[model samples]
Target: MSSAQPEDGLPVRRVITADSFRALKFKLSGARPAAAPADPVSLPQPPAPQVLPQERPVLAVPVEPPAEPETVAHEPPAPLDVPEEEPPAELIVENAVAAMPEAAEPAEAEPPAEAARPEPAPEPVPETAPVVAPEPPRVEAQSSVPNAGTTAASSPSAGFIERRVVERPQPEDPEAGKRAHALLDIMAMPTVGSLPQERALANDTLLRLIPRMPLKSLRHLAERVCVMESPSQLLVRRLINDSRIEVSGPLLEQAMTVDDSDLIAVAASNNPAKLKLMARRRIISPALSEALIRSNHVETLLNLLRNPGAAFSIESMWRLTRIAAGHPVLQAPLVTRHDTPSPIAFQLFWQLPSELRRYVLSRFLTDSETISKILTMNAESDGAPRKHADHSLLSELEVTAPGEAGAIYAELAHVGRETGDRIAEDQGGEALTVALKAAGLTRAQFGAIADKRADAEALKAIFDTLSFNKARVLLTYWDWAARRTGPYARIAAA
Candidate 1:
């Protein structure tokens, strides 16, 4: 300690000096020096106690002891309350003491976190209600800029970063595409070669597997087979020249099991070109030839018929005539033959109206012969084409079929040929009227065609052929057309 002036009125003490520090340490520990025995010399007697002021021979009596000579000992922190299932409390205390000096020190400074009393410790919990522990807060790592300093150690480099590129896989058949395209090119050609060319083409070519050689190509190939032409020879030589496939299935089957019409209609769609005319040929199927005659398919059918070097047969003529008779378009170009149509074909023929039957039969047989054929054919058929027996003509004459009787009158009225002899009788007016109206024509048109007015003969014929209602219908039509024009003007409303 020292005294000074002229500065602020504060006392100065050399507290940090070595002497003070030594004194502090000595006082802090309060440990006295141990005295040694006097040995053989008698120990000095204890000094008599003296009153401090009365015996004041000492210059300064240091009265006050060091303010805190007592050491400030800190209490050890209490052991934590963990479950017995866990390690013992003493082990936890030992662990914490080993981990952090602070954990053990704090309890000495304050009180143990809890006293180790046998009675349960006051829980580190609120007194009133059990607490719900909150979860520790999470922290997200933000993406960083380049040169980001990572806690992760630097990556190691070995053969991993030093490897070479890998090889890719190869195809199974590399030239297959070229072969396929080449085959397509050959198939695209228009024709096969001539016969010798055909033999060459068929002998060794890729085309052998195809059962049908195209027609145009077959034509060329047939020529080559029989004649032997140019490079056509060389090309066919490289083609199917070595191969053999079945070729007789068509002709053999045609000769054995098949007949004519089936041969045409059924096989035609499949092999029309092959079936075309061959000179002096007997056509097994002519009806089919004439069928497309009136149909829109006629063009394709005709091409098959007019194969230039080939001619058709008697059977073809029979079939053509039969079909042409039915179709108005083919009627002009009649083909004649003498096969004498089968009984069934003739049966159907005579069953039709006499006029149509005569027209058709005229082509097959002479006029007189056709009439006799019809007579014979009629005798054999199911009587006559069906008739409406209750007709007006029934009571007056024997004829009952509306169609048959209609035909008779149609002739007498239109051609004025006096069909009267054959007819049951001159027809009644009602039958004639009905027959005319039902035949689908206006009275005027019928009159103009017949070259006569609705005369007594016409009236008789119409009534004779008609029912009461059919007759009245005709009369009504007359009334209507006349009112619109005239003629039936004779028959007024009453």
Candidate 2:
């Protein structure tokens, strides 16, 4: 130990151990003394914070204060000392990077490398590329004439043309029959599952061949074609008026393709057989019946009357009755028609056979006596003169011969009857008037004489000469008689 002097000039003496000297030296150097190790059991722990009754304290204690946590100024961590490895031979580059000057300023503007090196010119593109479109379907060109399958040199019956594709006939080809047969064979080919195009092709081929086919072959073809489910209208129409009955018969009977106009044309033609076939069709229009009536073909008209499917206008029925009146065969069928008009039925009643007449009477409520009276009236009224009678003379005769008038009329009527001269029975208008006036005949008496005399005109003349009241009574009776007879009778009476 050594004594030391204080700055106040006071001498101080102190004894120092080695430990104290080491501690002093460390203190001056600002170094803390290392703490000695303590026993684990002896180490004092801090007091625990207060815990709420409801909460349990966790085992992990927080290291920092929540309110103002202690933040240590941390120094950056030292870089890891990783061992360096030698560069691979492939990664080594021949050109070394040039060292930049430490004090060098960056250049204000650098020229673009793209401007220095000219850009490669764009490659030219062709304007059009090869585009493939689907090809249109090929339809074989047809010749003007349709007999291409046959030739002038070929025989008419060219043995069944196995593979004949009849497109269109050339004008030079004369064997039209052979071409028709070939086209028919193609159409007859089993079309059960054939494509629409194939059926259409066959149809087009047949249509073209039809006009070119000879008459005989066309007729035979028509018979077969008419039986098809749906035959072409054009083909059926062409065959409908064919001059030969064989050709037109099947078409008229079976073809639905024949329009009413075509049927009418056929009916109008001078072919009874064709018209007869038309009458036998499944259905007939009123227009067709009229056309057949105009044809005046008895057999055709008869057939039309018999066909249950035939429709007739009132006019047509009347015309049929008029024509049928002379035909015994037509009368039976016309009477059987349920649609026969009442007037026509009455007209037919007179012509029908006894058995059919009973049938007609059963259908209508016509009075036979009334009809007879009408006939009598019509027979009398026809061609009767309209000469005015001397009404003044009638009055004078009534005054002079009132009692003898009845006897005179009876004698005159008897004499006229014996001579078989209706004109004598009628006498003159003046004489008939005078007799009627002198007799002062009642309506019933006048009607009986008029009907018996068969002279309605004479009755009219007598009526004209009578007094207005007497004439009215007679006129009413005559009107009733006319109504019972017929429409014409009624008009005449009026």
Best by lDDT: 2
Tens digits of lDDT, candidate 2, 1-494: 23345787444434232233333434543557555235322223322222234322122222332222122123232222222352211111100101213333111111111111143422222222223345687533333444654453265554443444444454533476676667566655666856667766766776666656666777778878876776656667767766777777888887876789888877767687787888899988899889988988888888888899999987787778778878777887887788876556654544555467445434543234555455445435744322333333323434555454434443432212221122224333333443454335556555645564555665554454455333222222333332445453333232
Worst 10 residues of 1 by lDDT: 103-112
Residue 153's C-alpha lDDT in candidate 1? 26
The clash numbers for all candidates, in the given order, read 53, 5
- Model 2 TM-score, all chains together: 0.38
lDDT of model 2, residue 166: 40
Superposing all C-alpha atoms, what RMSD in Å does each candidate have to the true structure?
Answer: 31.2, 30.9
